[model samples]
Target: MIRLEALAKRFPPERQALQGIDLEIENNAWVLISGGSGCGKTTLLHLIMGLDQPSQGKVFLHHQHLGRLSAQARARLRANIGLIFQEPHLLQRRTLWENVAFPLELAGQFGRALRQRALESLEQLGLGARATALPAQLSSTERQLACVARALITGPSLILADEPLERLDPQNAALVTDLLRARHRAGGLTIVQTCSESPATLPDATARYTLCAGRLVPSGLLER
Candidate 1:
């Protein structure tokens, strides 16, 4: 579970990215936050991931204050979180399987086990055959699916996806969305951000909210 209390973020001089955003996501619940570009949706996710510090207020991960933890502690805690970045962020030099297995290798699992887990994740994303291919050999959609495989390989307790369905064909977009929904249904907490909700992704959301000019708009039901 995660909780944010009066969270706010301001960049440099007068620009504000978020203002007093308070939210709670229960374990296994799926929440979607929608906002146009520059509207602070990604800023909110970064704060939650502890990649950026909150300018004010606090962020609690399962009741532990993020700002209160040391760097090493935060790094350890992050292993429990899966994140799909706005950019795929895949290493061009590594093959898809290697890229997906990198995190597990860093966490001390390698060789057969690492390959197996990475392959399983890839297969889940319908990318099994591309495991031996480099990033350059894949299409934009394949690249994104590789990123999703990388994120989910570790079986993280929570998933934070930033505009994950962008840059994909409708079929692929729906595939990825359904994967996330299935993960949530199977008891993994998920939080996704998009410029707007799509029919492919919003149907199973436990809660939904829109953000505008750094503030949360009133909650509304998203058509399934």
Candidate 2:
């Protein structure tokens, strides 16, 4: 489970980015956090991911307090998570398959099995033919899909996606949505995604919340 207790953040010169945000997310649940830009959605995700510290309150993942974890320990903890950034930060010098296999490589998996797994992930994202292509060679949509492929290759139990559908056209956005839904339905995957505007066909979230001016407001359940 993921829990946040009175979470808050402030930037230099007293710019409040988040305030008194309390939330809990159960395992295998899909949660959507929606808001306009500068509403602290990304900041919340960062705190949850242990990429940033909260000025007040605490963040717990699987009952482990993130603030107390040492940097090395936090790095170890993050190995279990799949993070999809708003920008597809692909390695310009690496092939798509190589990029997807990166996490596995970090965990010491190599050889034919690694190659096979990477290719399979790319295939699942409909980028099989572009597996050997460089990030610069692919279109924006393909790069984003490639980022998705990399994130899922590790089969993480929790997925943190920041504006995942932002740059895609409707067709590609639907494709990405369907892929995430399939994984969530397959069981054992908890997805927490942020968006400026929720998609029309977004799957019913286990819970939906909106952030405004650094405060989290429950948006209630979405109807099918």
Candidate 3:
């Protein structure tokens, strides 16, 4: 489970990014947090992912308090999570398959087995034909799809996606959304996706909330 208690964050010179946000998300649940830009949606996800510390209150992942963990420990915990940034962060020098195989390489896997696994991941995302291509050679949508493949290669229990659909066209957006929904239905994946769109846009979300001026407000789905 993931829990946030009175969570808050502040920037220099009196900028409050988040304030007194309280929330709880159970395992294997698909939750969507929707809001406009600068509403603290990204801030909340960063706190939950242990990438940043909360100024006040606490964030707990599976009962472990993130604020109390050392930076190294937080990084160790992060290895098990799948993270999809708003922008694709692929390596310009590497092939698509190589980029997808990165996490596996870090975990000490290599050679034929690693290459095969990476190929399979790309194939699942309909990027098999582009596996040998460089990030610079792919379209924006394909690059994002590659990012998704990389995130899922580790088969993480939790995925944190920030504004995933923000820049995609309709068909591509549906492709990404359908893939996430299929993974969730296949079981044991908990997804926390943030979007600058309405909750209704994500009909597959099991729970929904909105971030408004640094405050978290439960949507009708949550209230139900």
Off by over 4 Å in 1: 198-201, 221-224
Candidate 2 per-residue lDDT over residues 57-157, each given as its tens digit: 99999899999999899888887789898888999999999999998998889999999999998888788999999999999889999999888899999
Report the CA-based lDDT of candidate 2 relative to the real structure: 0.90
lDDT of 1 by residue, 1-224 (tens): 78999999999998999998888877766677887778888889888888889999899987899999988888788877788888888999999999999879868886887888888999988899999999999998899899888888787888888888887888888788787777777775565555455344366776677898898775665443
TM agreement with the true structure for every prediction: 0.91, 0.95, 0.93
Residue-level lDDT tens digits of model 3 in 1-224: 89999999998889999999888998888888889888888889999999999999899997899999999999888888888988898999999999999988877899999999999999987899999999999998889988888988998899999988776788778888888888888889999999987646566677888888899887866432
Error of 2 at 132 (Å): 1.5
Query: If both were scored by lDDT, which would come out higher, candidate 2 or candidate 3?
Result: 2
Global lDDT of each candidate = 0.82, 0.90, 0.88
TM accuracy, model 2: 0.95
Candidate 3 C-alpha RMSD relative to the actual structure:
1.7
lDDT of 2 at 122: 87
* Pairs of residues at least 3 apart in sequence or in different chains that clash in candidate 1: none
The residue pairs in collision within model 2 are none
